[model samples]
Target: MRNFQKEALILSVRNTGENNRIVSYLTKDEGILTSVLYGGPKSKLRSLVSPFNSGTIYLYNDEAKHSSKITDFDVKKYHLSFRESLFKTWAATLAVEVVISTKCAGSPEECFVMLNGFLDGLDLLDENQGQTGLIRFLWRYIGLLGVQPDTTNCQRCHKPFYSGNFSQNTLQYKTGGVIYSHSENGFVCTDCYKASFDNPERLLFSEITSKSVVYLQATSMCEPSVSRNMKLSDDEIASLKGFLYSHIESSVGTKIKTLHSGIGIL
Candidate 1:
């Protein structure tokens, strides 16, 4: 058995075996790890080991069984702001699941920074700006996983979504550049969306507007708090969320409970 301690974020937790709980953490040293938290629902650590909370965790690993148990968790922040509404809760849950699904695929430091920034930004965001804020966070998270769809050029038609300045503002709207297909495998230009219109094999394809392109470009490479938040209409939020969440589902190869649960709410 090996015992160790590290700074970690509580990504998720679930009750198990009546009293005990299973806790998932994004550790600064170990990336993403799941360990059993002994004791029942009434345990002292139960409250501390929660979604969106960051802290230091002490764990005991059993080498033969390849399993771990949490000895102690000292939380630094509870991130209670997101609990204010259903949408905010859904957005936070989405972030947690995305991080876990990707296994924090790059430098753990970079991934940790982006995740923290996103949660913080969401907490600070005004209610009116929730949609845009959520979009920015999701885009930033997707980029960290190294699977972000490139909107600058179409993978199928070999056409450029942008022109001179390499900015979303420079995208040529003419010749049908408004929409793009994010098939299960990869990206296809909006102009070519007709080619595979009836293929049921493709898991999902996003019809993103020029505004979405702009938003993606702006948030793709930066932390979530880079700029002031924007206000988007209900339809705009739904479309953007649908587009980004589909990319996540395709990449993770799993259903997203948080995204689907919202239904008409997200």
Candidate 2:
């Protein structure tokens, strides 16, 4: 009758029969953990096991049978604000799906810290601010998960993202901007793109605006614990939303159902 005590972030919950459920959690010690909670909707324990909630959890591990069951869950932060609005819920759900997809590839502790800041920022931010924060969070999470986009330089040419003679100024970018090449699986500089796609139909991709590239570079270096009030313009938001979501969708290899279905609110 082994037992385990851990601090966990509840990622998802699924009903099992009429009186039980299976809950998945992200813990500091274990990357992802699933345990059966023996209770139904009306049970107090069930209510505390909500997704995105984080806190100490007690599990009774059946070592002989190799399974675990939830005995207690002491919620520290419900992150109830995610449930307050559909916009927040979409971003939160997307984050959960991404985490589950990646299985928190890096160290469990680092992944936990990253997700903690993400939920905290979402809770404090309004819809618009949450959009920026969500972009930041997804980029950071993908980076940690080893699928981050390389917006800094061209894959073929091996030069810093440049246009005309402005290579000296890394801050300035012009031209038709960078292209997220599906075949190349990275950004291509103007020269490389034109040389490769001469009089061709680029059916797989469109240009990622210079501004979007800059945003990608900026957020890539920025820490995940950035302030919640971080803002972006409407244009920036739209471009980033498309670029980040598409990039994540491609990386995760699945349709981002939350974004696809929540198009109205999102």
Candidate 3:
């Protein structure tokens, strides 16, 4: 039996037999992992395993079986503020679902930090402001997961694009990502922009949305405190919500049920 301890954020919890539970968590050093809490419902550790709970966790690792068990944990923050309203809870749920759906590809530290920052922001937000934080989180998470819209070059041509040279920008749904043009209604790589004549999947990202995404990325890459102050227009917010959700749906090949049910709330 090997043992270790680290600070963790509880992503979710599931009851197994009687009182025992399987708790899933994400940590900066350890990626996402799950461990069984041996004690039943009455165990102190069970309640602390609630979603969005941040705490230090001790574990029993069985090297022989390549598994781990949560022996004990100390809850640092329970995030009770989210429970005050449905919108807050749903926003938190969406954030958690996004984390659960997207696998960690590179260093887990960035993703962990993003999750913590999202929760911290949630703690101080009201219904009207929560959506901005959630949208910021989704964009930052998409960037972390490495599926964010290509901003530099054409996905098809692999050539650099200058804003001054392009008159329009459009996001390609099929192959080419973002495109820019000086004369064309849709500015993409010259190759794909022309290809759109036959391919109907390409859609133009409105000027407000394209600029908003760039602004969101710029601020998110810096301090969360600064990102929290970021704002979006009604149209920009709606467009952004569609864009991020579409990206996630495309990646997972399925619609996020919560996103549909909770539409217009944010």
Candidate 4:
């Protein structure tokens, strides 16, 4: 058996056998890990299970050649701001859900840093700004996973997408993963779009308008502090948020409970 202590953020927790609970946490030292907390419900440790709470834990790793267990824990900081503000709570839950759903054990340090920075940003933002912060976090998360859509040049042809008075209605290849256009894969040239109109299955992505696509891609690469200054029209912001949320849901193949519960309200 091996024992160690580390600071971690509670990503999720669920009731187990009777009084026990299963906790999933992201630690600076260990990335993502799951452990069994004996007598969790009845013990004082119940407070540590809430999402967004940060704490120190004493873990016992049986080293069973496959998995490990956390027999005990101690709370450090619970971030009471989440309870005072409903949006903060929602944002925190969303952040936790995204990380929990996408992350595997032993991920890179960059993932941990991104998540930590997002949580800290949530703490600083007011309720009205939470949604934008959430969008930014999702964009960064997708980028970190290497699944972000290509908004640069044409996917079909290797041509740069210039910002002229281009047609607003362009189709994107669904399976290409990168590049945004109905006709080609990488960066479809105007000539290519004019050529291919016969094939089906190549659906159009009208959700991300040209203006919105430029902002989403640009904002994802910018510094976190400048996110609030990003000027997006209400329609553009709404479209970008919806597009990213749908993409994540489709990729994960599961509906996030927090997002589903507060759908009408958002």
Candidate 5:
């Protein structure tokens, strides 16, 4: 058996047989890990095993059963700020849920940094911001996963998109993702959108919203604190949220449960 200790953020915990519990952690060393905590519910470790808690945990691998055992843990931060408001709680939950749902292909350092940073940002965000931080986090996370849409060029024509005055309402979405226009029944350039089809009644997006997405794509590279300063209108926030969540759903191949719980009272 191999034993080690690492800093970890609790993703979830569930009661098991007797007083035991099953705990899932996003760790600094091992990434996403699940272990059986003996006498967890009745033990002193119970308080440290719940969602969004971060700390160092001691674990040992049971090579024969191919599992890990959680012997004890030391709590670093409970992130109690999330409980300060329903929006905070739900947004924090959404972050945790996304982390849980994501499948890691390499080192989880990036995922851990983003998730931990997002939780900290939520704890500090103003209540009036709605889910802006959460939305930005999703956009940044999508970019990290390499599934972000490219809005600078037409997917169909391969030319630099010229939005000009109608930047917001001009962008279109079809099978291939966001396009410069709704020409050729999908993502195409302005000429294509204008030239194809006799009827021009099928506009797929609005102005400010698509612009917000473009802004987010640009902001995704900034640190969370810097990105949080970018103010977005209500309509822009809505559009960005829908666009990001839809992309996340498609990439993760499953609906995020906490997201369906609604942003909660805000």
Candidate 6:
């Protein structure tokens, strides 16, 4: 009286009753799912249940039953280094948290594809790079969540932003979001920024350093290999990191534990 079949990405797992575990996964067709796995605690199966693994999972559900159970799973690829590097591991963990916490049940195919790409990106990291890879992963994850920051133009005046104009730049941490100057509502020209700041409530802008601007623009569009080739200045990296962290905190709406554990943030 039980039915079975599923291929899923293991998101998280925790030991439950003796030799049992509660496993969470996201399926290509069924979306996010939680299943109880009996005898998983001390068995070989436990190795397959770790985070960010892609596997074929065998599941069973009785026709008359309401809950499904995962009987077994075989890992297709175990991304070991992703689980090893402090930054890559935590970044992958954060990506998982975003997917599990924000994605709706039965999310679209795009979600799965994006998740796969994220894992692939993590696998490409090496020790020579700073947290750039992790930062890119987090940024793209934010895009997947549909809360990506507006990096295009002014939030209020709707003018295009150029790097040359602004002597000072600013961004609101809360709802108003990224702006070029204290005046312009969003990213704006220095002239427009000055004009807008003259009138309170027109726009609020934050001064972004030249190096910061270059790094942000470059990282967002550059290929992973290209990003690796590029070296960021200390001040530039710090500014970019602060910008990304602020956006993540504002958009994701939760503090990442991995970020706070001193395991990922570099």
CA lDDT, every model vs. true structure: 0.71, 0.79, 0.69, 0.65, 0.67, 0.63
Tell me how candidate 3 scores on lDDT.
0.69
What would the per-residue lDDT of candidate 5 be over residues 1-266, giving only the tens digit for each residue?
89988999888888889787888889765689899888734577776677888888899987998989887788877877777788887777777777777744254888888888788767777766647877778877877777665655555566653343222334332222233232232234445455544755546532333345445644654444454655677876776677566667766778888777675453
Model 1 lDDT vs. the true structure?
0.71
Estimate the TM-score for candidate 3: 0.75
Could you tell which candidate, 2 or 4, scores higher by TM-score?
A: 2
For TM-score, the strongest prediction is 2
Error of 1 at 168 (Å): 14
Candidates' RMSD to native: 4.0, 3.6, 6.6, 6.2, 5.7, 6.4
Clashing pairs in 2: none
lDDT of 2 by residue, 1-266 (tens): 88889999999999889899989999987789999999766899999998889999999999999889999999999877877788888888888888887778657888888888889879988887888888888888778868776877877787776343222343556556777777556887777777866555455565767657766676776543332333457876787778778878888887877878878776
Question: Evaluated with lDDT, which candidate comes out highest?
Answer: 2
Ranking by lDDT: 2, 1, 3, 5, 4, 6
Off by over 4 Å in 4: 40-42, 64-77, 104-106, 156-203, 253-258
Model 1: runs farther than 4 Å from truth? Answer: 61-67, 154-177, 183-205, 222-233
Q: Which stretches of candidate 2 lie over 4 Å from their true place?
A: 162-170, 197-201, 223-231
lDDT of 6 by residue, 1-266 (tens): 67677778888888787787788888877678888877634577776777788878988876577777877788886877865677667667777776776663135466777777778766766743536766666666666666654555555565534333222333222222234442222355455555656576553445565444444544566555555555676665666666666666656677856556643354
Question: For residues 1-266, what per-residue lDDT tens digits would candidate 1 score against the true structure?
Answer: 99989888888888888788888888665678889998866778877888898878999999999989999888888778777777778878888877777778655777787788777777777665767777777776777767777756567776765554432224343344345455434455655677676777444565656555655765764344342332345776678877777777877788878777778667
Candidate 1: clashing residue pairs, number: 1
Superior candidate under lDDT, 4 versus 6: 4
Spell out the clash pairs found in candidate 5: 183-193
Error of 6 at 81 (Å): 1.1
